[model samples]
Every structure is written in structure tokens, then in C-alpha cells.
Target chain A: MIFRALIPAFMFAILIVFFWTGLSLDPSKVPSPLIGKPVPAFELPRLSVPEQTLSSEQLQGQVSLFNVWATWCVGCRQEHDMLLAIADENLVPIYGLNYKDEREAALRWLRELGDPYAATAVDADGRVSIDWGVYGAPETFLIDRDGIVRYKHIGPLSAEDWENELRPRIQSLLDNST
Target chain B: MRVLLAALMLLPLAVVAIDQDPPMADPQLQARYEKLSNELRCLVCQNQSIADSTAPLADDLRQQVREMLIAGRSDNEILDYMVERYGDFVRYRPAFNDRTWLLWVGPFAVIAIALVIGVRVVRRGMGEVESD
Candidate 1:
């Protein structure tokens, strides 16, 4: 009787361990093929400059950081200082996608907060952001000279993010530059 | 003239009787509906909340939640109705009660019971001498 009762409990314990272990996994820690692979193609209108356009093709033979941000996103405001610091260093060119934001508001925010982007593209409908696999605003992607995606950050960048994650990746890309 | 006045008085009551359920639109009620749908879990798609899910049952539940909110029902009252009708499984975070205590504590309880039983079984087997 005791053995029978224990058998169900043993099975239940094993099942819980299996499911819990799977849930605790962090996808960011795992290597993504998109990492070190060509950045996906997209074309979008410039946010501030009328009749002008931007595309991933323009990044050929040059490293750049692609940031997806919206005026409505609180997290985007938090990472503004880090982005300005990155731009100050000029370690790599920075590109921006003003995702799902109105033209006037986006331009005004940049003017008020100090624009860090070399050029900003407006993805008003968020189609380009979707292609880039952006689930939310304030995501950043790092691309190498050959137009390969070297890194991806899901949320707002911090000082520690630049030092620990961005800086090292940028260094590796620069080292590999022909 | 007397008959017309009597009919007018009963007309609003008749309309109310036909509309047994509540109205579907009201700004404050809509807000409550949106909040509740997002918080409730889809039973079929355990990973997704009802607001984010495309499942048919989730859609029905969303509409039901909206109806309840529109009826001036409090959050707790709506939740209680669902719990009574569908049991606690409908809730994303099941309440801590006798029936659901198994769900919340099942894993820990299972591990503890297993450890105790395994040790006893091992001790008993060890006590028995093996024949050559």
C-alpha cells in the first residue's frame, strides 16, 4: 500500500522538476543564429527629413546600432542617457527606428532630449519593427560591418549594459573589420 | 387618451424585460472589462492570457467578462461567479483554498512525500539479508 502511494508521488515530483526547469530557462543566454547572421532587410521613411529614406542595405561595410523606440514607451526615456553616451564615444554609428510614433511627437522628443542617432527612420505602422522581431519598444540590435546582427538587447540599455554587453561586442566587430 | 398613457408607462418596463442582460458599452465598464480579460488565463492555452489569446473560448470569456462589468458587478463578484460556475481552474492565479491547495502545494508536497517514502523503502530493503 505504501509503495503504491509512493509511486504516484515520485512520478509527480519528476514531472514538476521537468516543467519547472524548462520554464526557468532564459532565451537570451542561448546563442541565436540571427546573432552573427545578416541583419534582416527593411526600408522605411526618415522620421524628420521629408522624402528621405533609410534601409539596412546602407550599413554595408560599417557597424551600427539599431534602436527601436516609441515616444509612448517609458523605458525608452530611461535609456536616453546611455544612448547619448554611446553616441559621444562614436565607437559605432547609431540608427534609430521611431517605432509606432507620430512624426511630430518623435521629432519633438528628439529635439528636447538630444538626438543620438546619425539618422532616424519612422516606422509609423511598425511593419519594419515586426520584421526585426521587436515585441516592444526600447529594444536595441547591434550589427557588424558586413551587415550581420552581432547582438540584441530586449529592454532599455544601462551603463552596465554598455560596459558589459555592448562595448565587448563592438570591440569584437571592430577587431574583425577588414 | 387614457389607453395611450398606460401603454407609454409599460413600454420602458417591457424593453427592460426583453433586455435581461446589461448594455455592452460604457467607458468605465469597458476599462474594467479590458483589465479583467488581460488578467484571466486561457485554459486551453495555459501560457497566454485571455486578452492576448485568439482561442474561441477565450473570446467567449472576454465577452462574458465585459457583460458582467457592464452589469455593474464588482471585480470580486465577477470572479466569484466564474469560480462557482467553472471552478478555480478559470483563474490565472488560483486562490488558496482546500480544493486548490493541491494545485498550489502539490509539487512541494509530492517531493517531501517521495523523499520520506524512498528513505523508508531503502532502509527496509537494507535490513533484509541477501541470499548467496
Candidate 2:
């Protein structure tokens, strides 16, 4: 009789676990399907030099971070100094995908704030951004030397995120380098 | 007086024209475009469908759908393309697959469990009272 009565309690405990896990998860962070997939092929004009393009070919042959940002996106500004600091660390090259911003504004942001990107691609119409599944600014994709995307970080990258989430992934990817 | 009346009559038509998005030439393709838009979720505004959302990303996706339809892509092809880039989260009605199989089957499982419990409860109640 006690065992039978305790069954409901066990079920409730299971339900609580499920609910707690679900509640703790950030709904805004949609898992990227592009994980372990090749970075989308795109060739867009560079923000600094519109004549010459920054293509996906450039990102290959090294582990790098492809960061999507726009001057209008406040989060990009929030993470800008940290990005500069990360570049200073010299662990990996940081590439910028300047999404749908005026060339003048983007150039000015880079000129003023300090350029952290090895090469910045200008996605003027956001078609390239869409191809990369970029719905918001300041999303970062970590790509391997083989050009496969290993991890995607949504929103601003903090020092804590870098220390805990990114450093370990970079280390593992570096370890596996052939 | 006649000119003023004519201008006034045309004002609403002009407003309506300006208010409307330019409809695609082919009605069939236009229908497909609308269908795809409603099916797609706007990632920026998570709750609203791309069709309903005024978010810039939604507008871009809607335009993209129209272009893809015009380019002779099938509905499934367009959906697959979106799913490839944005993942299944872009689909308002998520497809049944490895990640979402439980989501698809869960309600039915709950119903089956409820039925079993209900049947057991009825049987026990019937045991207490004589069955007609």
C-alpha cells in the first residue's frame, strides 16, 4: 500500500526534474544546426575596401572566430572591448561579419574602437548573414582549420563565457589539429 | 468642384495601394510564398510567425521566400534550405525527428496513461458497487 502511494510521489519528482531543467534553459538560445557543418560559402565586400572582397576562402586554414556585428547592435558594442582583448591574447584570429550597416558607420566604429578582426566582411543586405543563420548581431561562430563550424555563440561574449565555454573548446580543437 | 471630388475618391485607392506590399505576378507562387511565410518563425520575435512579424529579419525572410518561389524552388526545397541554415527552430510546426520525436509523441503518451488510470479507477469503483 505504501509503495503504491509512493508511485505518485516518484512521478511528481520526475515531473519536477523535467520542469526545472526546462525552466533553467534559455529559450532564446536555439541550438545551431550548422554545428559540425561547413561554414556557408559567401563572398562579400570588405568594410574598409569595398572593391576587394572577404570570402570564406580566407577563414580556412586556421581556427578562427567569425563574429557578426552591426553598429546598431548594442551587444556588439558591449563585447567590443572584450573582443579587442581576446585578439590581444592571440589564441585565434577573429573575423568580422559586418551585417547590414552603413559602410561609413562600420568603418567609423572600427576606426574609433580599434579593429580586432583579421578581416571584416561586409554583408550589406544581410543575405550572407541569413545564410549563416544570423538573426541577431554579436553571434560568434568558431570554425576549425578545415572550415567546419565547431561551435556557435549567440549574444555577447563575456570573459566568463570565454573562460568557461570558449577556451575549453578552442583547446580541444587545437589539440585535435593534425 | 468636380476635380476635387475625383481627387477625394481616388485618395483611398492610393492609400490602399501604398499600404499593400506589391503582389507577385503569379498567383500560385504568391500563395506558396504566403504559405511559407506563415510556416516560418521569426527568430528575432520568437512568438510571431514570419508572416505576422514586422521584424526586419521576418521581412527579409519573406522576401527570400518570394525570390526562391520565383526561382522555381519547391516548398519542400525552400523549407529544407531554411532548416539547413536556421535549424528546425525556424519551423513553426517543427518536424518530427530525433530531437522532436518526444515532443510529437508526448501528448498521446499522456492520453494513453490517463486512459489506463481511468479504466483502473472505474474498475475499482465498479467492484465496490454492484455492476448493472
Candidate with maximal lDDT: 2
In model 1, the Cα lDDT at residue A83 comes to: 96
Clashes of each: 0, 0
**What does DockQ give for each predicted structure?**
0.03, 0.70
Q: Specify the highest-TM-score model's number.
A: 2
Candidate 1 has what TM-score?
0.54
Residue-level lDDT of model 2, residues A58-102, one tens digit each, is: 889999999999999999999999999999999999999999899
Where does model 2 exceed 4 Å of error? Answer: B1-20
Q: State which docking tier applies to candidate 1.
A: incorrect
Residue-by-residue lDDT tens digits, candidate 1, A1-178: 9998897899899889989997897533322335666876888889878688898899778888999888998999999989999999999989999987888999999999999999999987655654564545688989888898888887789999999999998998888765
